[model samples]
Target: MATAGKAVVAQQQTNLPFAYRQYSAAELKEALRKMYLIRRFEEGAEDAYMRGLIHGTMHLSIGQEASAVGICMPLSEDDQITSTHRGHGHCIAKGADVKRMFAEFFGKTTGYCKGRGGSMHIADVAKGNLGANGIVAGGIPIAVGAALSAKKLRTGKVVVSFFGDGANNEGAFHEALNMASIWSLPVVFVCENNGYGMSTSIERSTAVRSVADRAAAYGMPGVVVDGNNFSAVAEASQAALARARRGEGPTLIESKTYRYRGHSKSDRNRYRTKEEIEDWMTNRDPIALFEAELVELGIIDQAGIEAVREAVRKEIVEGIEFAKESPMPDMADRERYVYTEAA
Candidate 1:
């Protein structure tokens, strides 16, 4: 393994006009562990909710781990990020405390918002998480504001706005993009294209076949890659982030991906075909492909992969225990964190 402070080596062989460093064995193993943790955590959340242990609507990012993990791995402690309702994966990827996250879902006082915000509204500002928004495109403007603050303060810190393809049409998306371009603010817009906006397919709703192609209209670079491909996602994200860091403005990345589940807990998903879903699951499986590449490249063996799974499982167990032991928020403080507190 490399020195503790050293950056991980990465492999990205895209035809784009940029190159991303490759990850070493240790780094790859660590990332895989984190990804597995996200997968397991969300699965557990789903199970608990189905068993009536959870309240409120649940938005699961079950099959969308690669985009969040790949893009977030490059962020620094001082950088900021804004996410959507499907944001648990994003929060986890950006290093949010898993225990606090579990507590937030359980409406416990130990959560990021002291249990006030619950699942969709969780965040830890000290860790650069600006919080997740329930409204479509709601977090877009907030992220732009964060980038504006970074520019005005000359902090040299970046902001990542994680949204879905559905958010592209919202006014905040365009307005924020225009502002970011005009000032050359530091931000990366990631569109997790999961093929549908609720029940509508991208083809029916999106005029542009590729969301990244829209970046040219804003006078920035546009790039598209297999969202399921972690290496591809990492490489593209690194390039966009580099440009942002250089004060070159925001870049739009459309991650071509799919979700194996419905939009939310309330969804029936009658609009999509089971055949289509299975195609992505079977053929376009992102994690499975990445594992294959790692093996072919001689980066890890089966034992190392198993070790990653076991480590992720252990961390999740601890997180669950922490959440279980946490105290719920006082019912009297229900209205807290909704607005400014009284003096």
Candidate 2:
């Protein structure tokens, strides 16, 4: 009788939201930590940039934390991902060291690209990050090529292509999706529809109602998720990942999220009003929403949440300090990595 009752309880637990039921308390807490790290890291970078510590402009992903962390939840380090220009969140979520990222921003030799790639081209190949592309929809075709390699090599690895809604209109986007579907490759296309491609809004640019709608033309499953909600994004990612692993082909996921910052540091945000940005920041903040869910589910308490924040604060401070103290690449070695040397 006790065994039967326990089974019933287990079944009941499965009825909860996908993330709640699928992930353990520890995993969920870790996800929360990553989200916090992403938030703080960007904030720290912004501070440094304003203080003239970093060169070149950067694209901040302040309000899109949930979408990045959630989509990466079901992925392994062996699984590859292609990132965009505004990809610090994705890099951190996929297990990047914040210190190296800061070092890159500071143009130190300790950076992932030895201080050469800076903000837009961070890549950790051993961790399966194919690097962030500067071109719109650039990573989509690269991800398909990587997936093709994985399939041909019989590596059983999956590749995820992360792009913005702006990339949906690009010709490369259509071609990549079509190729992935026709070949039945193990790849997933994730569109982070933050409502704007720079200053242009989606309604003004895209003909389709949703970015996922275009996936049908490529003959793949089109899924739209509340990208601001961590659980919803993770659930969709998990399902899509499973499908890819089964050799069933690609899935296009349109994550409906928002970005609090402008398109880049240069953007004045004149395209949108203060009221709209304020509303999203105040009410639809991804970090706050995820924290609320964690507390409600008893996965973490207020004190625990604060502890995580405190830890992340310390880490961010240490990362900035490390970047400040690290040596910059010497001028004499400027052309060292530019060309390949003969064996």
Candidate 3:
């Protein structure tokens, strides 16, 4: 099978483009596929949004799939993760159901949040996903508390907190990192440095060149990886997860990725330049990077990658049909989840 993202990288090329540990061909291929699926799903949703099929603001993760899957694949079924507003990739990477996620966005009764939370607040506690929070940096402290509970219960489960580059500038970010360090909690802080925090560039928001460098203040391993490279993100994620599992405390992993979409669905993406987006779109795609690796290793072909893409596309298509047919929750039931009348 030929890869959908075919590239002609010679096997004997002397110079490598990025810094990452060597991995088996199979591992690289798998990570790339998951990231590809994530990217496709988000893009599909964006199309649906434009068609007025999906209600509410969606933070499409057209990029940053590597950070989500790379960190998530290392967790056990029992391990927990706290996600961000732009967290469909994280939820999917943690084995969340796409149909149900679609239902949630459509505000159907069968949604993970029971038709109320919509796109930014999808949650599946049973699957160890606490939830995707709308408030910036709100999920960080909650994840710390989850890790603390894991330690107290002796669950041997680690919590992964996924946040954006903008979140690192928040007060809760500093407070959670400090508390987690002092308590030696089993939490992995994954900072997806996607260049912009909402509409603001990272350069204007912070003084530090990388979020991983901030880990130094907390006495933890602060490592940065090319977030477009799935293998690099995965390897670094595994190392951080291993440290958390061993009670060696947490690691601040900064994945330098890019977002190919606007900060939200309505902004029209006026903040960034077309050339900047094109640079990543043409050359820095995560799927393309993995396809090149696959070809060089002689593990798979362009057809294989295309099949994967087609299968995911079919699933997305079916998800739309399912969501549209799904009955909206009874308006009578709307007031049930959030509060109850005084007895």
Best by the lDDT measure: 2
**Candidate number with the higher lDDT (1 or 3):** 3
- What order do candidates take by lDDT, descending? 2, 3, 1
Global CA lDDT of candidate 3, please?
0.84
- Order the candidates by TM-score, highest first: 2, 1, 3
lDDT of 1 by residue, 114-139 (tens): 87788899788888999999899999
The numbered model that scores best in TM-score is 2
Off by more than 4 A, model 3:
1-30, 339-343
User: In model 2, which regions exceed 4 Å deviation?
Assistant: 1-14
Once fitted onto the true fold, the runs of candidate 1 whose alpha carbons sit more than 4 angstroms away are 1-20, 338-343
Query: Can you write out model 2's per-residue Cα lDDT over 51-144, one digit (the tens) per residue?
Result: 9999899999999999999999999899999999999999999999999999999999999899999999988788888999899999999999
How well does each candidate superpose onto the true structure, as a TM-score?
Answer: 0.93, 0.96, 0.90
TM-score of 3: 0.90
- Candidate 2 CA-lDDT value: 0.93
